[model samples]
Target: MTNAADARQTKPDWSAVRLHVVTGKGGTGKTTVAGALALALAAGGERPGARRVLLVEVEGRQGLAQLFEAAPLPYEERRVAVTPDGGEVWALAIDAEQALLEYLDMFYKLGPAARVLRRFGAIDFATTIAPGIRDVLLTGKTCEVVRRRAESGQGPGHGHDRVFDYDAVVMDAPPTGRITRFLNVNSEVSGLARVGPIRNQADAVMRVLTSAQTAVHFVTLLEEMPVQETLDGFADLRAAGLPAGGVIVNQARPIVLPEDRLKKAAQPGGLDQAELEAGLAPVGLADPEVVTALAALAAEHAQRVLLEAEQREALAATEAPMYELPLLGDGVDRVGLDLLARELRRQGAA
Candidate 1:
């Protein structure tokens, strides 16, 4: 098994991959990393024509739009826009009903049955509200993207017409609390479909997920709670026999101040006193009391820095492959995403 720590140090060669699944605890910036990785893969393409890349979000959260600085994507797979190098980036927010309908259309020839099932609350509840069933449909749709099929334009009536499209698929999957169960739907479906079409489809999806060609990247922050969750999530993935990818430490502090420097800065007789006196003296307002007040301000900043370092250290202890994306002062946008893409490429190259 590949260690997470090493994976963090190494950047992924997207050219060699077909599927990338991004997941983590909520608010850990998983979606941001997914978008950035897609951008990086697109930007790093060898040929400049236009590599087809699909960005899939399972929850309909519209997180990709925020990363691209565009509007929320609809349920369907739409050609949103192209990357800088002429590579295509298509975004899809998977609606459970649409995915189920697509699945039925492709497999069961249930054209009219789709609407009938929806009206009877069978398809609606199964695809939307049902726990494991929704996951099955979502994974099924993803598998369709990866499965090999011939393109003869024949409908389900022919039973031999299928299409395999898209160069790469990035799934912005569910949070850590539910992701294991979501991805394990194949095992759940196996009990029902002993050796039929559904079983075959589930097995194919499972193979891709478990294979070395695919990866599952977890994103987290440098805080205590998120780091703890990341550790637990890794263990869960391992226990479930899923391939564990590297962990992304998002919004990490760029510089860490040692204890000695932090203590010196917080001291009353440190740089703050002399710096304040120099400025005040120029204004003819030098006061010992004002110097003390300025020193307190510096001390507060030093304390915050110390706290940030502590958080970073706590995260580093996980020993998982870890990549840190510095927190931008102005917050993340398209330009920020592009910057992150460059960083990912650098890491992937390393």
Candidate 2:
């Protein structure tokens, strides 16, 4: 696949992937991972005009806004970040109610009638009282944006046109628990609309969703529950025939202790006070209190390393290509996000 930043460089592995849906267990940092992936795709094509990528959130949460350090986003798409190569990451927060209105306007051309439906609570029924339509609208709108083209500036007549085109679209999708139902448009709309425009719409959306052009990436922490969720989620995606992408392991702590040292530290009271004091003596006068503190620190490091190893092993069982993000000592902010994007690019997730 061509690089997201440069159409010239061929990185065929992920270049053909047009839609990237990121989902994981709650609190696994899927939103942060999604944002960083967008930035990575946005890096590297400085010479030619940079390619554009879109980031979307659908859970009514302002996660994208928080990560980008921007105000709460409206339903409309807006430019949120610029990459080193001048590529752009545009974001959208899909509001269920607004998407329904837009759907009516686009296909039915409801015009003033839309307000009447809203006033009488019909809009609420279709978007909320009713099931599946809301999910349809959310996923449908995202697919539409994925397929939308740039304005050619020439019109056969007077009609609205999409102003921008994206090389790829990244969705910070719902948690694993709800994701299958959320993306399974056929199942969602099956009971509600059997044979109408809504069903047809659901069909189109599913076509895009299950096609090779789209990939569903699962993010997870290197722990038991999240890893198990990742495994289960992948199983569901496979059962549904959805293309599963890579596994993103986030907030991984660094291994500070070397093997021999860690082995010694693992033993109860193995760190000798005299040895610690001797080491400290080179820098300055060693104290009994300092040696005790150092010994405690060694034990902690040993425990963390052992835990991390177990978690890493659990994550490896999933067999999906893995991408890891470091645990930022400082809280995650826009700058930290940029650093993460660089790491992702280096790891070839872009």
Query: How far out, in Å, is residue 119 in model 2?
Result: 2.5
Model 1, span 1-350: residue lDDT tens: 12233355454544456788889888988888888877776664555644566788888778787777678788756666567877666788887788777778888899988888888888777744455667777777876665534355442112322233556778899987777777877767755677876677677778877777576777888667777787787778878888777677677654444566568775666555676688789877688987787667667767666665566566565555566676877888878877876776766621
Candidate 2 ranges with C-alpha deviation above 4 Å: 1-12, 45-48, 153-164
Clashing residue pairs in candidate 1, if any?
4-321, 5-320, 5-321, 11-347, 11-348
The parts of candidate 1 lying over 4 Å away from their true place are 1-15, 69-71, 148-164, 190-195, 256-260, 266-319
Identify the leading candidate in terms of TM-score: 2
**Reference-based lDDT, each prediction:** 0.70, 0.82
lDDT of 2 by residue, 1-350 (tens): 11122222334347778899999999999999999988877777432335678999999889999999999999888889987667778899998878888888888999778878888988887676666999999999999988887765532111323344777899999999888889998998898889988999999999999998898989888678888898889889889888888888789777676788888887988677788899899998588887888889889888777776676677666676667788999989878989988877766677
Query: After aligning candidate 1 to the native by TM-score, how far in Å is the CA of 52 from where it should be?
Result: 2.7
Error of 2 at 110 (Å): 1.7
